[model samples]
Target: MKKSLVLLFIIITHQAYSQSVAKYSNEFMNIGVDAAAFGMGNAVVANINDVNSGYWNPAGLIGLEDKQMALMHSSYFANIALYDYAAFAMPIDDRSAWGISLIRFGVDDILNTTQLIDSQGNIDFNRISLFSTADYGITFSYARKLPVQGLNYGINAKVIRRIIGDFASSWGFGFDLGIQFKHKDWKFGLMARDITTTFNTWSIDEDLFSAVSDQIPTQDLPETTEITIPKLQFGVARSFTFSYDYTLTAEVDLNMRFAETNDIISTSFASITPAVGLQFAYTDLVFLRAGVGNFQNENNFGSESLTFQPNIGIGFKYKGIQVDYALTDIGDQSAAVYSNVFSLKIDWSLFR
Candidate 1:
């Protein structure tokens, strides 16, 4: 490669991977999944106590005593996009458990505008069509509790797929590792996401995309290949009971991305994001939660990025069934910024 051209390519790559651009592979994998987790500022790494743990820290499933399942749905970015998740867990033995989970996110019935032009350079409304852009994943998890009570470990293997109308698609595979330890009334958790590094291989219909490019020759899309960066999260949680039947749990978590300033991995950290959450429960039946999330932009307001958002949620349980709801204030970017999340959890043993 020529020296000058190589320099240009390097610059472009760095800009594309910048925190603001975030053109990361399988980016959808990072979606804040369930209502309970989202309610706690996505800081459930150590506070997970339900089947939804399959998506956060699978090790949290080691204590399961009954067959459990959960379902969650969210209307993100107002009502323009939809996100759904479901998971089922079964105890394999006295101290071992397995779970399967699926997540799907999509923007449905999107009008395809590329083919809106007619042969006569005149307006033709019929040329426009509707299509969907979707992303999905399937995960298998296994967790085991060590002979030393309260010590557990888990691993997850997952397959991911993304589709953009009928023009492009990508498939990816990745693994996650987690460890959890509890002593007295405190819990500690560690999770390594994408331990083996996720790879997304894209297939684009050259002819179809070329047609769109020809419509406007000034700009073109970049290559579709992608490699996701690995990140680590650590969390601690503690509960305090004040009254006879009321208890409060507090949690703190730190997320670190192992990338350098140039978006390259190294010993140095690219960013360290911190979050805090609090949950109040009444006799383990009704719960209220609130938290703050994504404050990484606070240090760099000049970047035109959002600072942080407030999360609020409430849930109740009856007869071995749990229901949860969460509302996230996504700043003033748009009236549709608020996100609504709902989730339901059930223990099959209750019926048996």
Candidate 2:
């Protein structure tokens, strides 16, 4: 029975063991951090300026006035999976800034049923074990103001680690580039992720893998190497102030992938997803945000329909400490699993 289960798992992951460029490789890293960004439909690429920017648009780190830190936790699939993130950033002189961030997404305490039956063909209740499958990402970022006025640029070096309950593990590396420009109340930004093509090399435990091969006489095993292609995000934003106390900001973003997808705009060469976000503020203390994104064409049976994900959030800020909450969807509206996201950000300047 244990061998049978292992065979099933191997069959399900057969394609994953091949050397290829997967469209959804390293997907957890793209989930985005910070409830504020989630509440704003991830459209703040143009105007973001905080510790969280290390994941969104590193160039925005240049906006940090002092040391800053942020943390976030969210659960998905009804709490079966947990996602956590933490980041720190500080200004470097007046022309440059640097930041570091860590992210983890995992399903914990999974029962390892492969050992449920003992070698003596007897049921061994104590043979069962617990393990976890998790993915971790660490990013180092640096940003500097360009010689040209109102322009800033940033770069990121990323290391990725993945583990599967001692069954398999992998290591990967990648790079990202970002640029942000501000002119008056208008902002523009561009982000290029996996610019050099991230690659993951998987090292499978042969002792564990052989257990499956022993069950099947004609099975071959091979090492796996996965690749992630480049993706680009472009954004524009503007802020409006009224009555000396009221403010509103609006932003638009375009996400472009290299291959055809279910996005609203698709071609053989590329696909584009558009997102729009709005924020209303009172003296920059209290805030309300709403946005919609993840446009896709869902096909039910033989019919197709358009759907999107909508998000709403609120925030409170006092003396450089901010708390934000967002109600967002893990997937698009077509098959949505709503999740509540909360995040906290602190400006160390207040303590200094």
Candidate 3:
């Protein structure tokens, strides 16, 4: 009874806090995957491992006892197709480990347009430019077991690139720092990512323009737009075992972005999300899992004006290989019903 009440209080507090900072950028990269599974519950950062850890919490590498490699991909309802992620991790010794990862988010065939008018009062057709947009990041990571029993610390550096049509693109760099501690039955985790701000500039060419009206001739104009990524994410989670094979866990996350006076957009908004999950393991050979997340408003659309109110997922494991899948709804739009994600993971180690 008391425990249930405490859980309720925590959920309410987390929901209120999350509403305060609902506006942020690079949402495609941040939305995450392993739906139906990770989405069903609030994505708890501390427990993350496998390939997703490259994007969630780098410190999780400390808990990995073996060499691991993983990949994940998803196709959203719209014509949008997400690419894949791959990661490899190996322990140097009992106390230290190192890893590398690659993540790619891609979109297919977008229509290209140019500002032009023909003599017959008709629009001039510019050659169709079938191009795609991609966001790729390469990351290097290291983690060490701390002197304090179950405590671990780690960091990761990432080089990021964004490519649009022939007209625009950008490159940037960032870093993430993380720590985790476990005592008895309690666990805690923290992560600070995207420590550096990145930007991209585009130059318009004069040849791409044509005459518009009688007096005004279309001229290519050069302009630059800069996007500032968010910084710092904090998470905490707890797990309890009800039986030898059944366990329940809860997790919460907070993303913080300090506002800059010189920036056109303010970063005062923050997002607080909480998640709960159930895991059932059968004789260590097979496992079943389910989780749900962000049950508060369940309808509030943040920066994208797209509501991502709920998510669910499942996973299976055999020997050293594991597979996971998730489904999500990014709200229904006039053009399409948006959401979907899939993931695969593998871990191998030569123990001493």
RMSD of each: 6.3, 2.5, 11.5
Worst 10 residues of 2 by lDDT: 11-20
True-vs-predicted CA distance for residue 1, candidate 1, Å:
39
Candidate 3 positional error at 262, Å:
22
**Candidate 3 minimal-lDDT segment of 10 residues:** 211-220
Task: Give the CA lDDT, 0 to 100, for residue 211 in model 2.
Answer: 51
Instruction: Give the per-residue lDDT digits (tens) of candidate 3, residues 53-107.
Output: 6567777777677888777777653646566777788778988888888877776
lDDT of 2: 0.87
Give the lDDT of residue 62 in candidate 3. 70
The runs of at least 3 residues in candidate 3 whose Cα sits more than 4 Å from the true structure, single-residue gaps closed, are 1-25, 33-37, 40-42, 113-126, 198-230, 257-278, 285-308, 330-338, 349-352
User: Cα lDDT of model 3 overall?
Assistant: 0.56
Model 1 clash count equals 0
lDDT of 1 by residue, 228-328 (tens): 77878899999999877999999999877766432112246466767788899999899999987666333244554445667889999888899999988
List the global CA lDDT of all models: 0.76, 0.87, 0.56
TM-score of each: 0.86, 0.93, 0.72
Stretches of candidate 1 exceeding 4 Å from the true structure: 1-23, 120-123, 216-219, 260-268, 298-306, 330-336
254: Cα error in model 3, Å: 3.4
